[model samples]
Target: MASENDYINYEMQKRTEPLLGVVIHNDASELNANEWREVLINAPEERYVQGIAHYYIDRNGQWQAIDTENIAWHTANQIGNEQYLGYEVLESLSSTDEEFLLNEQETFRVIASDMIDYNLEPNRDTVKLHLEFSETECPHRSFEIHTNWKTTVDGIPDEWVINDLKDYFISQIKQYMLN
Candidate 1:
């Protein structure tokens, strides 16, 4: 059987388009290709050496699909993640239960294939995790990746959290400081 890493690489090598960059989150916010497989069954049928940079949601309550183009609030680096594509894996209250979605994994494979088909370069180098960029333990619980997700640099908020704590904090701080 084809391994997950192999599937990911194959998808990446296929993308020929030049893209902004790839954004990864330590939270369950990123989407793996396996979950996407449900939407596009034929993804496995295609052969790709690389994968696409996209976003996804966790299985906490219901599976919500995140937009790849829209910027997220997950800031690992200090800079704003305005140009990078974001991908989030799902996380639950339980660390042991945070299983990687097979569809998300498959979706990742197809995305990599799409990028290769378009002839583009991924955001930066590889996928990134929330904590890798900064000091916060985001993606919460068991949402952390074991590999390349560690590319996050220190003091880089280029990739920030979206519509979550980041926003909440900005709102709360603004309100509290104003009094």
Candidate 2:
């Protein structure tokens, strides 16, 4: 295995796009922040990686990732990958509803903190889901929780349903941002 310094030096690339805001995703695994970090930092290629997101949240709490300025290969959309910092909530698919809620809520708080730090207001434009830019059912946990609905078609969330999730997330983030 490669040493920590052997990969993901946070110097491999720099963001040329104007920093937009935050893009949220799910880790899709049961691993916590540290475990996910190990997986990502050691991965030999971006295609095989889970994340190097700016933050990871689990029931244990939130880990605001160390590298803030450089680009991370989280969002598949090139613009989002460069302009928006990504946050991963531990697991949506594997975790029970109760467990997922705990992790999701914790993610909200950390995102709120990052928003405040970056002077971003909580809204649809500032807070985004991975699915917003792609066809995947990413952030599936939040999609189900906020909309109380599932995919109507192929695994892709309906356009309006994703909006609902974004609204719910923004509201939650606002609650934390104010406090």
Candidate 3:
């Protein structure tokens, strides 16, 4: 019989390399962080293709479902599964709420801290959105709300990239470290 810890041990063994960056995703179900955790924990593990995300962020704040060293099942097409750490931001059922917004900002700060720890750049090289690999419009509201914060690339507006978002987080991290 497979031991209870077998899966965890297998996941750890499979992660032989360091993560390359971070991938941001949205949990479209409109559940808060804690509720989402309950759903994931209760659901069958095999339902996830890449495995569950390493972290989740919502009105209740950030929660780690899996260790960063383990590969998360957040990306589609198997893209960046082994190369990146993944985070899922909880989506509200209706209009976006202030609590969710605050949690989102906190999520960014966490990502920025991770970037500093991993020595990754605050740009496309280290930060990415789920849309970059899949056709679905995941993290939909997040993109919509942050459209004005986009950066220009090759003289064209690139609204979907996470560079500007990362930049903001990086600034926050700098300010935090200075204090």
Candidate 4:
């Protein structure tokens, strides 16, 4: 029988790779239910084929977030890009509003629930935090953030790829580097 870690690692790898694009949101706590829903409804339609979302919470409180596989809206007009992942954190760096701590757990639960139906397992490698790929102080600085996000550093392993797959990724990397 496969160990729990092995199963988790396999599931994580499956969720992490084969994605077209990834979308990172700044923060989810500032938006209300309607606003948040609208954002989900008006997501981008460019290269966002598949994506995941992340959120931060202050001390792990209860929170509720929405999940929309198709519909989308933009908070700052950044959701137009298609084929990506999304995340919403429930914490604030500059502001100390207790409301920010509210519904965070629920948001995480809902996000996780959506992942189950997302046809992909929940894995840190596949899902990225806002801070991981961006230079902004987004997702908050005080909030304890999760870091398994696949930034440029945590790239896919060569051993994980077959000969053909390895060659394809290598070529792609070379092309990316050249460009």
Candidate with maximal TM-score: 2
Best by lDDT: 2
Q: Of the candidates numbered 3 and 4, which has the greater lDDT value?
A: 3
lDDT of 3: 0.61
lDDT of 1 by residue, 46-93 (tens): 421122224443333222233433343345343324444555544333
For candidate 1, the lDDT comes to 0.37
lDDT of 3 at 114: 73
Error of 1 at 174 (Å): 43
lDDT of 3 by residue, 1-179 (tens): 11011122223325566777888776776676666566665566465544567777765566676676677767774556777888777763453567556656667776777777777765666677776666656555565565543112222225534555546545554554344
Error of 1 at 98 (Å): 8.2
Error of 1 at 94 (Å): 3.7
Q: What Cα-based lDDT does every candidate model obtain?
A: 0.37, 0.74, 0.61, 0.35
Kindly list the per-residue Cα lDDT of model 4 for residues 1-179, writing each as its tens digit. Answer: 11011110011111322333333344534554334334443455331223323222233332222223332222222332223344454344333545443433334444444444455443434344344443434443223223322323444323232233223323332343333
Model 4 clashes, total count: 38
In terms of TM-score, which candidate is stronger, 1 or 2?
2
Using all chains and alpha carbons, the TM-scores for the candidates as numbered come to 0.38, 0.84, 0.73, 0.39
